[model samples]
Target: MKIDSLTSVQGQQKLFDNGNARVTKVDGQGEQPQPQQIASTIYHKDDPVLPANYGTYDIKAVINENVEDPETMNARYNRVQELFGFGIAERSVDLELGYLSGVESLSQGLRDKDWGFSIQDGELQVIEGSDSLSDEERSQITDALKGAGVEYAAQSVANAVIEMIETERSPNGLSRSIGRFDVNQSNFADVVDLRSFMEDYQVGGKYGKGIVNPNDIQARYFGAGTGIMDQVAAKADETFLYKGR
Candidate 1:
């Protein structure tokens, strides 16, 4: 009826609809792709070498890392031991001094070895004799008895009294006095041994003219004795007489 439609629209619309409705096919063939299984890899290695024992370990390195130097550590240890030793030694000396001081405080009248209170004339005479002894005589008697080991106890008492007196006047005097006494005692022993050796060996030969041929060794011994006596006198004066004063 109308002019034949210039355009053929009948199949064109169908083709467009078919194309829009079509679904793409997926190929589920050959080994279906597995999710790439990746396991977490953890690598563990051996521990480093270490020292076996505790103290035996390289002390230097340990000290460097943990404490101080080797020398400082050793010195500190030794100093501790020394301090402990000194404390023990000082305590012993103090105890000894205390005992001696107690003995020294006793009266001379009560110091007699015999406990008898008899008033005999012979005992009185003996006491009077001792009272009259000069310093030199007292020293000689003390020395003789000391050599026999019979007067050490008495001398110790006397020394203790002297120490107390010195300590009362000067706080540290007793310690100093003890140190000096030890040194002098050693010196005295050495001198005596030296003299004895010289005498026995006859180090020096005879000298002088025919009639006046004198043994140089004997002369030397006399001189040495005189010198030693002088030194002894000086030391005694310094130690006993002037210490407290």
Candidate 2:
């Protein structure tokens, strides 16, 4: 849904008061209409349909008054990093799927099912059954990836095939990958490179790696690091997370 559809109090109220009425007899008949009973009955007349409420509400002015200007805060850096974390998580997933499955439209696949990118309760979750790849059985994933092209795609598929071949692989592989990358400086640098590549090549920015066609890389990795930060902010009950001193 369009963000603009969110509720504002700009429109007229849906409820109405039917004017308190005194009964008037039609031709002085029908038992004087019984004083039209003042029992507060509600009725609808022919009026246009009211717009549905979109659940938007104004922030309290008093709260806004006490907050610092976001533009002026050095702490914004920390907040940015936090957001980057979620983005990284999603990116990792996208990269794994793309490099492994040779599917360039993975993000669109998620979006089509309304499972679009989201940070919920300190985690990045793309609901299962929301994407085309996700709808397939394990055997199908193996077959598709094995036939995919690109060196990275081949390697990724090999890894997946191996994992599926194993009996007791870790169930939290994705989560653990995100957590591990967050604490690993080397991984972070790789992410920076990936992000830069995305910006320069994929997104048509000046600083991209330019080694490969930017469009060949999936869009999911471009801003996934930001997704992590969104989860942090949402979970911390803050709009922005300042690097804690």
Best by TM-score: 2
lDDT of 2 at 232: 25
Model 1 lDDT-worst window of ten: 12-21
Give the per-residue lDDT of model 1 (tens digit) for 1-245: 11011111122111011011111222334233222111111011121111122011111111221233334434433332222212222222222233234324334543332211101211111112223544554444334333433233323322332232232221232222212222132233321222121222122322111312122222222212122222233434334322321
Q: lDDT at 214 for candidate 1?
A: 22
lDDT of each: 0.24, 0.26
How far out, in Å, is residue 132 in model 1? 46
Worst 10 residues of 2 by lDDT: 54-63
Model 2, 1-245: lDDT tens digits are 21111122122211222223222223322332222222111111121111121111111111121232322222322232222322232334344433334323234433234222212222222223334445453233333333443223323322322222121111222221122223222122212222222222223333223323322333323333333222222332221212221
Clashes of each: 0, 15
